[model samples]
Target: MRDSLRFYLGDELREIRDVDPTLTVLDWLRLSERRLGTKEGCAEGDCGACTVVVGRLTEDSQGGKSVRYEAVNACIRFLATLDGCQLLTVEHLKGPDGALHPVQRALVEHHGSQCGFCTPGFVMSLFALYLNEDRPDERRIDDALAGNLCRCTGYAPIVQAARAMHDLGDRTADRFNDRAATAARLKALADEEILSVGSGDRRFLAPATSAQLAELLLGHPDATIVAGSTDVGLWVTKFQRVLSIVLYTGRVTELRRVADTGDALEIGAGATYSEAAPAIAALYPDFGELIRRIGAEQVRNMGTIGGNIANGSPIGDTPPALIAAGAALRLRRGDATRTLPLEEFFLAYGKQDRRPDEFVEAVILPKPAPGARFRAYKIAKRFDQDISAVCGAFRLSLDESGNVAGIRIAFGGMAGVPKRAAGAEAALIGQPWSEASVHAAMAALKADFTPLSDWRASAGYRAEVAANLLLRFHVETTDPATETRLVGDRRLAHA
Candidate 1:
């Protein structure tokens, strides 16, 4: 299928008529156009070498022109995904009069660049921020450029440039409001084409619909599904996997939705960590912070929940919380769909139970129980943007008498895969809520799974911590030993 592509890189549309649609937008920008401002330090999304902004139409009160926008990594981002989306790159920073955009000008004035290789990526990310916000806070600045890295100079100046950019851009916020006609025209142009990128014998297919996407997948079941490419990109960039037929999900609007039915929360399969973070955090506060720390903002903006789950890394942070929360995954094929327990979706190392035609659709989460004690924790070497040594989730229910009714315990990076501690839960189930009970539950962890020693941690360290986590959970949920408990419910009293 041939699709039309429209992107405003300055004042012109680089409409390539009827090209293969699966090409990386970065490949098109760097190779086809020779813009070169966008770097490719890492072909994966993490390095921010190919950061770009997509100015999609957004609605506001005035509604003259919608100016809402988001920033994404261009390296792994497919060119077909830009069909109807406004493509903003570092090259667009110059005004018609040759004046630099606030971000670029500030970088110039503040000497934010030294070696200059990383400047364009950072500038584009900040420019995306400039187009979106009139006033950006420190946290906002941090969030906007989290995916970018500068090796030449200290990050302080770049951050200062962000502050100055916000101040300068705030003065003309109303003037920059996109004209309604312009936005309407752009939105009208969305999804106008399909382009595939081919290298050697490998082809990446990115169709705009499930039927079209499924046909590509069904025909090529061996094809790798590329959603955000946060991990698989690592396979290509670092481990050097020979990837053919990367089926990108960005054009699948059905996968970007988020819904709440009061009883349950649902997130589309392609919902990036950036897109679904706020809702996921609102439902599970403890887990929200973890999501924030998952890579940087750009990675979060590009990485999808389904991609993280599908990757099946033992260290993936989302699965432990998801498994503990009793979520379900929606999968779709040509015309058929199925839902399965989220925990059951994972089978082994880097493997899932999905059929050849099936791909993840959405993740459904039920409402938390009333007065239920819930918590999720991540133990990492560094506080931010680091992989976890261990991540855990706990949920507890109490009976009318306040005794433990049920519990779910899950952990990542402790075993071969993120798994529920069945033996631990069995020890706590129907047992009195006492120190002895906590000890019993902790001991059960020894029987659950024997952990392995890796570069991040040792087997003994994992086993000991896994068991101790249960006792710690007990102490955290119940009253402290130092504090006297006046429990009218005798069941909760000390033995």
Candidate 2:
């Protein structure tokens, strides 16, 4: 067991001890390290002004370790979570001779900065993109920079900078390009020991394995388990809630696996949305599209599917989609484990069916049959980086006669929980897949949920949008080429 938190900040090895468990990465960077490159915009995960790239050792198919760089919101990310990883800030981008990196040079050349407060974040985000992809299209560029919001200089120049970064020079041949050494350092840091930092009520523990996590959870039942810290980070930044015990699940190896077991897709609870996206998109395209709109690229990189379900938020985007797909939850408590239907896990607002010692291990999504039609839609105020007002997911299976043999409907933001529309499903099952049947199901939706009004939308608007989303699902499934979405298809007519 180790009490000290060890990670690499730029090229320097840092061994930290006796620090507050809830200390955010942004604070540690700016205050402790005295680096002023990473700025704080919203203090929450919304604004990308605090964006920084993290490099973690990832094992490939051949059992070789390589560094995987991802941009994350430093303002919300806890400092304790940086154990066994490499932290890179905007200051680490310049060459040894003080020459600007390709990402920074491109931004300067394209006039991507105005007031320059948000420029560091934009550089880090684009640097991550530049490292990962050889060339990013319009969609990829938009997705990469979606988390960052610049009030002074519009996104047009930033978009141009992202497009022009690759053309500057050889992006891969840089100082941090020595993946083998970085991976070796990371591997050496992964000692497979339980990290217990801090004492008493204020504590942070990161277990290296699932068994260790299970034992720790059993010991400290009240400890808050955090996988990605996407939502939990807000409790400290926005709500200013002082967490007593924080048990981080990022180091638990088994919890990060994503596999297809022939029958169903088994996504480990710790798998980030970015890690699980390809497999999910392969199974259902529309569901993947909804994930793309979850909270921009930075959020997707840090947010986990299990955390999304375990948090039990009424507006969580994945729950409705997973419920519609007939997903199952695998939970663990010490040596004991159990499986339950995904919809049954959520009981009410801010309440889940999970015991304090029990943690969600995996989510099993059953593959739909050949005759199944699946669709998911999210109605939010803005197109990106916004919470959902109404999220609807549908799956319908037709028999030989084209009648609804079996159907499942789930919705979020319409009730206290991410619930299945039992009334709506009952109305559609055994009925023909036609316009009249869909209308009947839409009417039955009112009986299933009485949505509450909030600033994002009114109750009446929620009701109307929920019903129309169902109708839209019907229209989409009935006609293959309906062109229902307004913004999905993007093509550059002329530069």
Candidate 3:
């Protein structure tokens, strides 16, 4: 086992010892290392001023090593999580001759910086995109930059800079282009041994396998299981809570695997949203779109579906969609494993069916049957990087007679938990797929939930929007020519 955490800060290998387990990467950069380019904006993961890129070794199909670079928010990212990876900051983007990188040059030429506080973050994000993509469209650029916020300079110049990146020609000979050496370095750092860091009462344990994690959890039931730390990091930064024992899940390779069977897709509990997005999209496109809007790229890259479900927040966007799609969860405790329906896992607000020593192992999503229609809708104050006021997901199957054979409707932000609209589903089953039937189901929703009035929406507003979303679903599905979604229409027109 290694006592000290070792990682590459740019090209220099650094070893950190005896630090607090909850020390954030941003603080380590500014206070400890004196690398001041990465700024802390929100302290939380919301602002992108603290953006930085992480590169990890991945296996290519040719049985060789490669590196995958992902941009992450540094403010909420814990320093202990940097083990066995390469951390790249804005300081690493310059050449030996002091020439600005292509991303920096494009930003400079297009005047993409104003006030310059957020420029480092934008440059890092663009740098990651530049490394991954040669030429990205406007939509791709928008998605990549969604996590970054520039209050002064409007996004036009930044968008222009993103578009102009490819004109500088291929960067095959760049310093970062040689991933084989980095992959070799990362591989040498990888081991099956556990990582135990910190001192006294504050400690961090990163197990290398699911069995180790299960055993650790069984031994220390009070330890918090942290994967991605998207939500748990906020407890330290925003709420000023001290975590004593953090059992990190990022090192558990078994928990990070995603398997696709012909009948269903099984996503590991530790898989990040970025890892699960393509598989989720292949299974259900609407659910994919919903996942894309859950948070910005940084959040998606650092947040896991398992953590999202395990946290069991009432406003979480994925639960309603998963419940409606008839998803199930696999949980493990010690040597025992159990499965339960996804909706049943959520007992109430700030509560769930998870046991103290047990942890979620995987999420099993059944494939959509033929003649089935699925749709998920999220209503929020802003279109991107915002929490949903109300999230609705519907999966309806039609019989050969053109009637509603079966239906599952679930909603979040409507009740204490992500729950199914049983009354509404009961009203729609065996009924024809028409406006009248949808109205009956919508009316039945009144009995299903009495939503509370919050700052995001009033009780009456949620009720109305819930029913209207169902109506909109019915109209759009029933009429092939109806363009009910304004966002879809606009995106299509732009395309």
lDDT of 2 at 64: 75
Over 1-495, each residue of candidate 2 has an lDDT whose tens digit, in order, gives 899999999989999988788899999999998889999999989889999999997767676778999999999899999999999999999888999999999999999999999999999999999988999998899999999999999999999999999999676786777788899999989988999788676889999999999999999999988988898999999999999899999998788888889989999999999988889978887788889899978899999999999999999999999999999999999999999999999988999989999999999998877868788888887888999999999988888998999988999999999999899889988999999999999999899889999998999999999899889888877875663444445421100
When superposed on Cα atoms, how far off is each prediction in RMSD? 5.8, 2.5, 1.8
lDDT of 3 at 404: 94
Question: Would you list the rank order by lDDT, best first?
Answer: 2, 3, 1
TM-scores of the models, in the given order? 0.86, 0.97, 0.97
Model 1 misplaced stretches (Cα beyond 4 Å)? 3-6, 17-23, 57-68, 109-111, 171-182, 191-202, 239-242, 432-436, 479-495
Q: What lDDT would candidate 3 get against the real structure? A: 0.90
For each candidate, the alpha-carbon lDDT, in order, equals: 0.75, 0.90, 0.90
Q: Please, what are the lDDT tens digits per residue for candidate 1 over residues 123-163?
A: 88887777767668887787677788777787899989988
Relative to the unseen true structure, what is the C-alpha lDDT of residue 316 in candidate 2, on a scale of 0 to 100? 96
Best by lDDT: 2
Judged by whole-model lDDT over C-alpha atoms, candidate 1 comes out at 0.75
Q: Where does model 2 exceed 4 Å of error?
A: 483-495
